[model samples]
Target chain A: MFDGITPQLLFGQLLIGVINGSFYAMLAMGLAIIFGLMHVVNFAHGAQYMLGAFVAWLLLSTFGVPYWGALILAPLVVAIFGIAMERLILKPIANLDHLYSLLVTYAATLVIEGLIRQQYGSTGLPYSSPLPGGVNLGFMFMPWYRLWVVVFSVVTCLATWLLIEHTKLGAYLRAANESPEVVESFGINVPRMMTLTYGFGVGLAGLSGVLAAPIYQVSPSMGSSLMITIFAVVVIGGMGSIAGAILTGYTLGIVEGLTKVFYPEAANLVIFFIMLLALIFRPSGLFSGTEKS
Target chain B: MLDDTTAPLLEVRDLRAWYAESQALQGVTFDVRPGELVTLIGRNGAGKTTTLRSIMGIVKNRKGSIRFEGNELIGRRTFQIARLGLAYCPEERGIFSSLSVRENLTLPPHLKSGGMSDEELLKAFPNLRARAGSRGTSLSGGEQQMLAIARILRNGCRFLLLDEPSEGLAPVIVKEIGAQLRRLKAQGYTILLVEQNLNFARSVADRHVVIEHGAVVDQLSNEDLAADMDRVKTYLGV
Candidate 1:
């Protein structure tokens, strides 16, 4: 392994790992927020992500919208769809057991994916990079778009963190997560808050999809393929923990990336293996302490 | 300072509530005036808490009327009812564990114009000021109870429904809470309190409503309560 490994290869893999980590972090944060507030796993997240990519692709091909326009427009469109779905489908079963919600969203995922698959078919569609070209970093050649994805993801994540941790509305979200009834009795509309929270979470996933479209081909199966890994990240981070999800997601992505360099066969299995170990030892989660809101 | 001629600020009439299929409040009826502090005195499981929950719209499957300032509250959501100026401080002292003491204090949005300022609240409860950055759950029992009541006061809600504010506190703390209730009442806040402690009730309340098996069994003035302590004790099964 050492014989074949070069500085360029090591740094190249590291950058790729960070890029993958950014996507993971974004998706996991969304999952955690939705789960924290409504206790809904939002299985439709994957489908919504696929929809984001498709929306971006459609915008460019049909209406001549730029990559910049789709970046904002795609997520907004997906979020609106999410809000409607929450009100029509998720709200009714909100009081039921957690399993009912999971099954319902899982069903929604199938429906959404099936509809997209019907229209777009199984082939991958290309999304041209908005920030094209690369810069030579001494160690490795870095694509501007790839660097943009990492920087954009970090900023988005930081903004979301500030929104939840520092703002008044964030305080409401945190309190409502603990006990919605108590929060409501204080004159806050918890039901509306729930709907918006679902939308926000779904929007984050949509944003992640747009970011991934330039790097990977936009395909229907793209989201579903990544869902398992995201779920594993969420579980290992501890359910409904924002900081935990973000930190664990990046760590797992990097670890998996490094594994590909050292032991190619183990790359795919590493996240699940860690997840299993986490479940066995710290069943609550590796970061349950930070799981408060 | 009891005024019988003044219209009741909150009138609860034959309110019936259920938790799933089991009924909790069965035809419970009472009223609190604009500036009076009333206590609902009952033994455990006599629906004292249920009455408050129904009024606050926490118990969803509730029937009958809860009129606050002449506005019917039965059809309204909890938040809507709260917006109409009724605030609840629950028995469990619903301080969000995830929030800091400061966050907990400012959690509820102001519903009216007369809420106590933050400076005033801090002056009133110095412990809260000291633990402003501390997580709400880190507080002691008395501190948690104080934080619960303090949060509601910031909302400027005139009518307050407080359940067991003194239940798990020390004697000194109970007295302090009683003093706070008196001050609120003097400042024109109407309160409907649920209590198992008759002494606590007698200390701050102008009137008492005795509940038994989810209905109002008897009503008494402060004078009537003082004159008939033994009978009231028996009525409460104390």
Candidate 2:
């Protein structure tokens, strides 16, 4: 089984693994951040991701906005929508059970995805890669767009981690997760902070969507498939653990990719097998800790 | 309404709050003048914590008139009440386990430079200064209480609402906390403390407002408390 495997095959899968890992990191980090702060599952997250890609596609197809401009604008637009959803829908029920948010967001997801499907008829749309070229490293071929995505995702994730762990504003966000009433009593508007935090988390997913548009088809169903994988990533990571979410995301993606190389049949099922093993051994996750910086 | 020229620094009138179907506070009323230290004393479930929480506007389902420095605080949000110079240190101490002592000290936004500067706060809390880089929850109980108080002091709130500052401290630490409060009062900071420890309250507080089953049963100045210790004790059930 190992005799026929070449460097091209090995590194190519690893490259694919890294790219998938980057998306996993972004999506799971967003989910973890939102849940850590407010305990909302945010089922509409996939819809938000889809909306980001759709918004970018629309900007290009209808308004003649270039990919670079869409990359900047799409995430912002989706974040604004998230903020509005938080204010009008999620905020009122925030104090209720954690399951309420999950249900509401689930309903919201259906409505959003249905609206897009109704217009586009569920067919995939093509998005030309902005960086349409590749480099031949002596061992493996590398697409500039894939490399860009990997670098950009890593940068964004690290920036977010630093912001939450090192900055004063991040300190407040983490504090609020522990005791929102106390934070509010400290002259910080905790409710407003909650709203903004939710928006920011959703924005991260939107950013991932913009990045995904070129790789995956710009269809409403795109987010749903990836979101399922991200949910598994988040669960294997742990509840509300930022470090766990990030580390598990990339590791699992790579593991899945490797499974594809050696045993093609097990690629799809590999992540769940790992998740089951992790649950039996370390249910809290490999990087689980109290909601800490 | 006729007292428009001046109002109490902190005032509450007929404040009622409920948690779901259970009523926590039933028409509690109290006031604290500037440059004074007031303590609220009661047995557990007597609504002492609820009263402080009500004044902070954290109890959402509440009907009351809470006036701070002539400003109506009833309908205002918690952060709004805080920005108006009211700080609440909850009974649990509300320490952020994730943040370092230094981060916790600086987490609250300073509305103005009034109570104490960061350096002054650190100087006052020697333990906090020593363990500045440690997580907020790593401190001892007494130290955590001191850090909780110190965090608010550096936050620029002139009026402080502290719930059970001396609840679980040693007699010596209680004395130290009492002394610290006295010093804060000397610097013209008004404090409303909820106390389970009668001796600590009798030592530091200028006055004691006794709560019995969610209402103000009695108000005693230091002399009054000293004269009638038994009655205050009966009210406190300690």
Candidate 3:
């Protein structure tokens, strides 16, 4: 069973795992934040990710812009879209049950995916790797752009964690989640905070899309397939714990990668299997210390 | 400690408040002088909570005028009302379960001017200091109540609208809370407390206002309260 195992191959798979982990970490972080603070499952996350990739592709292909510029401009563009969705779509139903939010976000996802499909078609568009070449690390060859994705995502995750956990604004965000009325009584505008948090959460998904575009083929449905796996990661990690989501994402990615090496047939089903096990043993997920919202 | 010369700290006139389509308070009127301990006593469904919520602008369907230091509160948001020197502690205690005792006490965004410090909170409820690192959910019910009050005081709101601060607490803890309220009053803070516990109300309140069917049924000072048991029983259903 272990005859084909090699350091070079293992290292390559590890790099791939890390790259996949980066996306998982970013996406799960967003889902966890939105679900935890705002109590919305944000089913539109996948569509938002797809939208970010599309925006980058559109800017690069339509206007002859560079990938470097697309990286910054695309996420900002997607963030604005997210803000619009929060203000116009989600705000009205903020007081309603979580199912309403889920339904609304699901509808939004459908509309977004449909519009993009209409404009761009279902074919996967090619995007040339802007940061070409790789570094040979003796045991494994690491592509420069893949390494960039990992570094960039780590930075993004850490920054988000710091913003939510360390700062005064973060304190307000947490306070609002705990008791909106009490936070309001403390002179903090909770509605504004809700809008910004939704924007920020969706913005993370958008950022991940930009990072993912060069690695995967850009298409309308790019985020849809990945969204299911990320959701599994969230469930396995827990929806309310940000650090838990990120850690579970990266860890599960590695575990999945290892499974791919040992038994390629089991690679796709590994996350789901783990999720089933977790649900049976710890329905609240690995790091969910308390009952979920 | 409320001086007759100073303007009223909180004034409500013909206030109407509701929950969804059901009206909870109708044409309620009252005033809280600065540095006064005013108690609102009534049966469970008599709109005591609604009156407090309306004054804090927590109720969505509310009408009539509420003035805190001469500022209109009818259209203001709860946080804005709080920023204007009003704090509300609901009957549920509203402790942040994820946060520790110290974090819960210090979590409010804006600190009130001349509010109690962490040292003061620890002194007022020393048990909180002993359990500063413990999560809010892990604390006993009485400890949670103490944490809630300590949190609001730390946030620095001068005018407190405390809803049933004594409900469900142990007798010893209720006494501690009463002592703290008296201390807060002596420090020149204005309090409007809504309580079902008559003994708790009698311990700290300077005056009592009873509500029945959302309207003011009676008002009495501590002197009158000492002599009038029948009125208390009738209005408060005690």
Candidate 4:
């Protein structure tokens, strides 16, 4: 195996790894943010991601919307859908146990996936790449679309981090996460903040879905397939740590890619294995100090 | 003693609250006039904290009237009550671990005019000025208590509900807090403090309302509280 391994193979896998990591980072970040405020695991994240891709596909097929248009519209549409879910379903049950939220969102995932499957079928649909080009780096050819995905995801994640960490709005979010009652007593509308926060978190999932469509193919089951891994990524990163989610997502993605190159059979199992290790060694997560209990 | 002729800044009439089926505040009644530092004194489980919480609208399963500035506070949300210029400083201090001292200081947006400016607040609480960049939780207990009060002061709230500000402080620090409360009262701020420290309460408060089994069992001015120290101590079971 070592004899056959080359720089071309390694760098190609590395790029692929980074690309996977980008999706992981973006999706996990959304989950972390939602959980941070609402204490809801948002089991419907997979369905939301799937919805993003389907929305983009529908826009292109039905209204002749281009990739650029879908990139902006898909997340907004998903955000609206997420807002409705929160207000109508999540909000009423908010005062109940966390288990109720988890169950409700899981049911939502099933419902959304079922609706899409009935409409579009189980088979994957192709989404034409918007960039449609590549750059030769001597060792391997890197597609412009893949490069865009990585850059866009990184920028999106960075922007979110800044919004939550540096701004007054972010201070409200952080304070709300700590003690919503205290924050509300300070005259900040916490319920409204929670609604908007849920919208924003799922919107990130939609953005990730849009970015993933051309590469992964739009399908009902796409999100469910990735959901387990994303959850594992979240657990390994820590339950509610923003930085943990972003950093672990990218790190684990690369780790999986490296496994694919070195031991192809173990690639899929790698993330779960790390999650198991993290649970045993650091149950609160690797980067949970900054987040609420 | 000040005249009791004017309208009360806050009037709690038959304010009953419950945590699930267990009742906390039962027919508790009180009045804090404008510019007065009123203290709610009781033993543990006497519902002093619950009274403050019910007033802030933090306890939803509550009955009766909480009128602030003559507006009914019952049936309103916590934020709505806060927007009405009422702020609560909880027993836990309720500081955010994620926010820096500066962020925590400026976190609550000013609901009305007359809130202290950043310079004025930092000047008033000099320890906060020095640890402006530190995480809110990183501060010492006294500093955290000070920050809790300081945050609410910036929100333009003339009426404050502070719960146990000197619960775990050194005597020196407790003296400092008492001084701060006196200064705040002199500046025309009205306070409703929940305290088990009768000595501290007598030092800072204009009047003391004693609660027993969730009802307003007694009221005393500072002189009366001093004269009736043994009886007050007996009421507190300490």
The lDDT per prediction is 0.90, 0.89, 0.86, 0.93
Better of 3 and 4 by TM-score: 4
In terms of docking quality, model 4 is medium
**In terms of TM-score, how similar is model 4 to the real structure?**
0.97
lDDT of 1 by residue, B6-59 (tens): 898888998999999999888988888889899999889999998998988999
- Return the lDDT, model 1, position B43: 87
- What are the candidates' interface root-mean-square deviations? 1.0, 1.0, 2.7, 2.1
Q: Against the true structure, candidate 4 has what lDDT? A: 0.93
Each candidate: how many clashes? 0, 0, 3, 0
TM per prediction: 0.98, 0.97, 0.94, 0.97
lDDT of 3 by residue, A1-293 (tens): 88888998787787788888889999999999999899998999999998888888899889988888888888888888898999998999988999999899999988999999998899998888888999888988888999889899889888988788766677677767888987787777899888888888888888888888889998988988888998999999887688888888889888888887889899999999999999999998898874322
| Tens-digit lDDT string for candidate 2 (A121-212) | 79999999999989999899899999999999988989998888789988999999999999999989899999999999999888999999
Give the alpha carbon lDDT tens digit for every residue of B125-226 in model 4: 999998999989999999999999998999999998999999999999999999999999999999999999988999998999999999999999989999
lDDT per residue for candidate 1 within A89-155, as digits (tens), equals 9999998998888899899998988888899898999998988899998989999999999999989
What is the TM-score, restricted to chain A, for candidate 1?
0.98
Among all candidates shown, the one with the greatest lDDT: 4
Model 2 clash pairs? Answer: none
Model 1 interface CAPRI class:
high
Off by over 4 Å in 3: A62-65, A290-293, B1-6
Judge candidate 2 at residue B27 and give its lDDT. Answer: 89
Q: What lDDT does candidate 1 reach at residue A117? A: 86
